[model samples]
Target: MTIPDTGLRTEPGSFRDPTNQVFHLGGDVLRGLDEQAARDYRTLAGTEFFRTLLAAGKVCGTEPVDPLPGVPWTTVLRHERIPFVSHPYEWSFGMLRDAALLHLEILRAALDHGFTLKDGSAYNVQWRGVEPVFIDVGSFEPVREGEPWAGYRQFCQTLLYPLLLQAHLGVDFQPWLRARVDGIEADQLRPLFRGVRRLLPGVPTHVHLHAAMQRRHATASTAAVRDQLRAAGYSRELALATVRGLTRLVERLDHPATESHWADYQRTCGYSAEDRAAKERFVEAALAAGPRPRLALDLGANDGRYARLAARLADQVVAVEQDPGVVDRLYRRLRADREGRVLPLVMDLADPSPGGGWRGVERASFTDRADADVVLALAVVHHLAIGRNVPLPEVVDCLVGLTRPGGRIVAEFVHPDDPMARRLSANKPVGLFPDYRTEVFERLLGARCRIVRRLDLPSGTRTLYLGIVGD
Candidate 1:
């Protein structure tokens, strides 16, 4: 027998679901299923129930793929790939809230038709254009009474608790979710107790109640307690009502924050007329680098200024930012006009998503998305290398790895004595980066790509470097 198509570049978070495995096939997505799950998939694909949801535009439509006869019982039915893979951590408070609401809505719809979803992870729901689509069909199992929804606590932890963290404490838990995929635990909430109890109602309910329940269950019999709650008339309908109430808590807890930089991005922007002209000229020259990419990854896309420029030239642009407020601003702008092909997301560059699954073969990582023809690293090196404590050579290695053989990289270097660099000097980056001179950077970059162009910014301190790999 020939080997299976077991090649993967990166891993995604939601690969642990027991029913079916999601994988990438020649850049397309395919799901492998067991006998039982395959039967459910076949049953669901032909049903009026699924068709109703698809027609209602509540979920993505599933096209049936018949496997070859006598292929292994564990074979996959290839399917059409989704255009985007979104993480709950990348979502806004409203986006996450809406996802929670949509999850409950989909589950309730499923329950109405005498079916039950085995899972309720927020990671399973992805946005299609402007709507959330439940893509995990294998998660649906037959519904029965007196059995608690297995994903209830997950719904609370992943969606409910983190959202409450944002509202009650004004802390966007998106960053926290990246490291801990299942989301924060209760003990983690102990520190957030100060103002949350006094100011927010929903925060107290979801956070305190959920945490308390988790701590209590550390030694107590959970099955007995669950059975008790079930016998106490907490049926699926009643449980769903409680879930709806918990979702409403987000409305009461809704308080968007305006943090440093994003709140006054336009005001604090130090771009002079000449500086703007020089930067735009650099970008214009960078955009002209060959056939143009269908996908572009704009690292450090602050408020989407450069991403908007790149979006003009590409069909899809993934704008990555660590600051939620900036990402929020970028997302709001993108969502408001609906004119640009910009997908702004909040993600830390240093510790990005990784490949995950059985032996880690199914899902891809954040770095896999970095394989773009064009990568714009405008004014971003200081943050990743200096601010985040990554060494310069390693950073260069990452930038080079992202590009195609002839792909271009546009990066900015702020000198040690510059005013902006002076402000960041106290952060120990300058001490660690004593050897990172402009000439040294050019030499290292030249080793990987041809130094196509370099110029002094009108601001008089920073310089932009445009290079193409292997000449």
Candidate 2:
């Protein structure tokens, strides 16, 4: 939604650091960095630290971009755009912990290479598979001997504490973090996590200890705290050692709960013989009719059941789910299974990823990655329409938009008379899609897509409609 990525919005974005903003123009994204931050970015980009990261394959590729010839007081760096952007909160436990460790690793390396992270925010990292890659080149600043890790308390609260809370206390800290759009404050977690001896084994020492230590910084005079940090040996080597320690702790974290969807998929979805046969018939027919779609977006891919079926038709599927547990299982299966071609991602379609980064150039909005050859919205519209109260037509538009022109849309309709649909509308009958009935649906299809076929299942409640779009 920034100035450079899309022709959609060239408006300046709401981002921090006051030094830069991002704008979009078609496919290219532009960053607006202030003169001071631009200088810092140039120095950091020229440094061997970034070179080593690229050399080591730890980050997305970057190239120095020429400024708009007459643009004033800003520097531009063109980054190989990530197909989609996700946040630590949107990340599964494995993803969040991995990102936290990545932040520490990047900071450690930056220190060794004569630079330091200008900030420690969870927003700086993105995942390439399970690997957390650094996306912020401008966040690094040259460090001198006396300065404390300006990001110390920030790192502990942002990375270490939330992770420990999730791993040890079995809390889905994402909602808490999402509530506090900024990182989780240490004080909030400290009181909640205290007196839990049962959690001792999984609890990292850093979370509690760091919070206690940070209290002193807030309580003491700024001069006294800075002096104390210097006295306590907050040098470059110390930052590296601290970060390495956090990394080791993060690595040791397994998901706090072993009850994950993919691991338990067969158990939970042990669909009755009749149910399985019905769903399979619908999926197989859809796949057989469509051309091989190289990319597919699975809207509500709970444990990737139908998505996996459609994968029989696509080269890769980005399975989207808001449940971290489900996404964790999905990620593990995609990464570990030898037959894997799925990219499991955590996305709440209701509030998909939004724009961020200095001037918004740093991270692309979540919708930027919506392109797909076939879009599967199986058993998903119910949740969006009834659960999220989104209108059916709007939901249909969103799903259909994900596919290319002539791309296929696989949609499932649940009859209002069905028991499931009855329960979904228990609060109030918000009205069924009366206009999208047999006649209207066909006409709508004629306008936008050719209705290839409609499968009316033996069960009266369900139907699958496949349509190939028109130009």
Candidate 3:
């Protein structure tokens, strides 16, 4: 299908399906439905089932629109754009779990309305704050009797197994999920379970049995599997039963968070009340005095202390933390408060997320997506420089790249004598970072950004600087 060039551009990651194509027009998200898709959409749109899902916040609501300038779309739907688009790899454990449950919930509800989901890709779900909302409206189609759910194995690979691995083995799933966008396969994850864990109730059926079946059918053609399912008399009732069983298994899964070094940073940082208060004052003054930013990025947002502060001054805040446990806790707190301004993500600043999927543009890199009006880098310079062995000039350049031109950045510089800095540099020689002093940092930063303000905290160990990016 040829999409019109009314300054409307399709999202790179959204080209997998031909039934519906998503485009951005003047910052609004619009979905163009093909002939068959438009017909099916008309059927679903007229039903109360779709309205109920929208009302319950189970799916994103859409408004109908006529065909655009030159495109000949049968039907177009203007969907409410999410404030921020986060991927499964960036989500915390609880976030992914809730999303899995939401997927199954929608599946169960759809069956009641004579509709079924075509696939179970985790990308189909996005977070509106902490609430999981289905974004793929085109996945819905009329149900057929004697046909098994086509998304069954996909759900297992993308959502079920990832959750089970974390709940059972205590392994962090973020890295693996990021490495393999398709999620872990059954064959690879099967051997990870051993001893008593292999005997668990759902393990035998969902994990072990599913893995064995996949191995047995590895060489089988799609036609062969269809014939086998047809001969076995697959029905709608059986599909629903399978979904219900998987829901139960996913609901029972849980991962107790282990404490990270920075999780309790405020209490264990050895900062006096006066020092902490002074830091807060500097941050507040910086936000109040600077130009209001629509989007804010908080690097190394431990427990989201500063991110929450920035949320009050910006329209949206993206909190990036390296530790999954800290991000999980932050996500839970955001959900409890129903705070939609802040979005917490699991990311390591030193490595950062790279742009990789097809042609290296399907999924944008961290810097590519971050065009923030303001960025908060609190107590993180030493870790990036001394701990990660990143050059100080490179760190400054990265911060500059994160903020948009003429945007503001509130960053803290830790002295070499500071406890945290000392710990990070304990094993290294003193002369290793010969140019790590504040003077050199200021000079380097001043080359790319104009320093608006600088404040020395009462602790005499750290200094905060507010700078605006140069044109």
Most TM-score-accurate candidate: 3
Question: What's the lDDT for all of these models?
Answer: 0.71, 0.68, 0.86
| Model 3: per-residue Cα lDDT over 351-427, one tens digit each | 88888677777777888889988889888888899999899899999999999998988889998889988888889
Residues 362-467 of candidate 2 have per-residue lDDT tens digits of: 4446566567777787767666866677776677677766778878888777666555556667886455544434444445545666777777666666667787
Better of 1 and 3 by lDDT: 3
How many clashing pairs in candidate 1?
A: 10
Q: Candidates ranked by TM-score, best first? A: 3, 1, 2
| Backbone collisions counted per model | 10, 10, 0
Give residue 404's error in model 1 in angstroms.
Answer: 3.7
Model 3 poorest 10 in a row by lDDT: 1-10
Listing every candidate in turn, what is its Cα RMSD in Å to the true structure after a full C-alpha superposition? 4.0, 5.0, 2.0
lDDT of 3 at 129: 62
Candidate 2 vs candidate 3: the lDDT winner is: 3
lDDT tens readout by residue for model 1, 128-185: 5335677776687767687777787778778877877887778878767655666777
